[model samples]
Target: DARVTQTPRHKVTEMGQEVTMRCQPILGHNTVFWYRQTMMQGLELLAYFRNRAPLDDSGMPKDRFSAEMPDATLATLKIQPSEPRDSAVYFCASGLAPRGSGEQYFGPGTRLTVT
Candidate 1:
């Protein structure tokens, strides 16, 4: 069966360490998204992509994080010089475009903890 897969299921790093998370969306899904959830802010959409192109990432801190689809099957989110406040669970979800026509498939998610 097809599924969304995220790498390094968990991560723990010191304040200045860089973190890289990866995702592989279910095959054939053209739209992908990145989301982050923390106790304080709840869930927030960090990035959106369609057909391997990034469409929006305004919800994320531009200087600290980056989201990209290197190809059809792979999506990546990276945080450089991570801070303690960046601790959170990050999720990658994929679905068909045209907005809400189908259900979204989400990966188990990558959990990051910065100290």
Candidate 2:
């Protein structure tokens, strides 16, 4: 009965607009991840956190994108000056691990369209 939840399932904005997506991970889960999907890159991990602390975000564009967990249950992704190339489905997933053997449960996703 545990599930991840994301807000504003769809968004449309002109180029240069800022976009923010939010997620609520399942309670008691210590790990959360953000991923972006596109035809070219397929599915890429943008960021991940454990125990509400960011572990890595090198796959994300440092200048324009950021990921963070402000509290135990909430995670956030933000893009400033969004571009057409940034259009994609962004997913948030949460899981617990025994060093990489656990299953991650994903939220529905936020589909963004940058014009």
- TM-score of each candidate? 0.95, 0.95
lDDT scores of the candidates, listed in order = 0.93, 0.93
Clashing pairs in 1: none
Model 2's TM-score against the true structure? 0.95
lDDT per residue for candidate 1 within 1-115, as digits (tens), equals: 8899999899999999999999999998999999999999999999989999889989989998988899999999999989999999999999998865778899999999999
In model 2, the Cα lDDT at residue 86 comes to 100
1-59: candidate 2 lDDT, tens digit per residue:
88999987999999999999999999888899999999898999999999988899889
Which ranges of candidate 1 are over 4 A from the true structure? none
Screening candidate 2 with a backbone cut-off below 3 angstroms (N, C-alpha, C), the clashing residue pairs are none
Worst 10 residues of 2 by lDDT: 95-104
Residue 39 lDDT (model 1): 94
